[model samples]
Target: MSAEQGTHTHHDDRATVARHAVAADAAALDQAQRTASPIAGRAAGAPSGLDAAYATQHALIARRTDRGERVVGVKLGFTSRAKAEQMGVADVILGTLTDAMGVDDHGRYDPRTAIHPRVEPEVAYLLGPGVEDELAEPDPSASIAAVAPALEVIDSRYRDFRFSLDDVVADNASAAAFAIGPWRRPADTGPMDNRAVSLEFDGRLVQAGSTAAILGDPGRAIAAARRLAGRHGFALRAGMILLAGAATAAVPLPATGVVGAEIAGLGRVSLRVGDGARTEAR
Candidate 1:
């Protein structure tokens, strides 16, 4: 093929990929939503890398937004080097959080509506006005208004909870639901490193670890988000929450019970789970 023909073919291929990604992402999300079933993983047609994967994620989030799901914040995933290496991903990734995905501070979760629910503990960052402006780089400390204990609910659409990096990214990092505790200024959680994080399901310790498990310090995840979001032509914005990646491995959500997390300096946050439906605490 001639140079001009090759250029045209390349552009056409890009457009085709974009269209296919949109359709595939929408199908995956829609199926996951309707029946609470774990759909098949994207294999041969999955995006090639982080950029392409995020493009597909944006498409999926856009569909949610179109359906009136307001973007509430962002969540970081795989921030721990161990997790990244285990998952075979080169770096940490992000996912969009919608207001609809929020479980209030002490909300109740219904496992039946959630496909393969699992939870993780984390230190949440409340961004300030500084992030709204166009800065070359955001200072995690400067942008942080407060910190809190957070619990992230994750449910992968991929069958059997297995997926390639691109598949997980395209699934918006498996964001399902999240809750945050009372916020405290950074001073309250002084030097947030190695702080203990433990989760209990129905009064039994299900997962345990320290903040150090999350990329040494959860603050680094915020910094990474700040830098990364800017490259995508956006800002984190004030009033938006950022759930620094999970500090410990996720544990399956009990069929029906109260699940709680105790973060050494951040105090406790809990969610009650039912078999059929969910209720938010006012």
Candidate 2:
């Protein structure tokens, strides 16, 4: 074969390998989610880099979108500096959120929907129209229409919830489900930073934290999301929800009970598990 022929053949071979790897990763994760069973043994085909990991993530989320689940927003992970430090990473991660993942306030979050689920407190932002235009501005949080108290359920598809950064990224940041309370105008909510936060299981306080734990201010998460979305070549449409990273450590979701999170001045949001269920300083 000529030299040009060999180069083309090698390129095609690499492309084929990448496609196969992404398909396998997506299939494994999809099956685990659908069966509510965690997979053991991270295989050789698992994504080994950020690009491959995110490709797997997109393919995984695409499976649900193809099944009619609409993407409603995005969720961030490891936004807390302390948590990032703990994880030995310098940056945060993000995951897509679909309509299927949202549990209404006071709505039930079926434990059978996830594998080894855990819950954490978060601050959610509602984006306004033209928000995408603000992504490059000095303050991207200016795109926020409102803020709310929220909870995110994380269930790693991997056994024992053990995985590397790339592994978790490929699993959609371990995102399983989420719930948001009534929206409060950002003006009415006061500073996004330093809001007292708490999570309760059946009226028993399970965890407590502050919105300041979310990258020093939950609003900053929007900026991070904007950059990440742009880097991934996805648009952040108006009306999309952004769940800032957890403000407190996650606790295992109870088999059955009411899990609630309250943000000072923002109000409260809750999820009912079969019952129901961070770190920081940016």
lDDT top scorer: 2
lDDT of each: 0.82, 0.86
RMSD in Å for all candidates? 2.9, 4.4
| Model 1 regions lying over 4 Å from their true place | 1-6, 43-46, 275-282
Q: Candidate 1 on 1-282: residue-level lDDT in tens?
A: 999999999999988987786678666765685588887766356557677777777878888888899998998888878888898777778888999899887777777777888999988989987667665365677778999999999998878899888788788889999989889999877988889999987667888999998878888877778767865433478999999989889888878777888899678888888854344333
TM-score of 1: 0.90
Q: Which ranges in model 2 have alpha carbons more than 4 Å from their true place?
A: 41-43, 275-282
> Looking at candidate 2, what is the lDDT of residue 192?
75
Per-residue alpha-carbon lDDT of candidate 2 for residues 1-282, written as tens digits (9 for 90 to 100):
999999999999989988888988898888999999889844467648888888898999999999999999999999878878988888889899999999888888789888899999999989877576843573644688888899999999999988888888889999999999999898887887898999988888989889888999887887788889888755688899999899999999989878888888889988777832311111
**Highest TM-score against the true fold, candidate:** 2
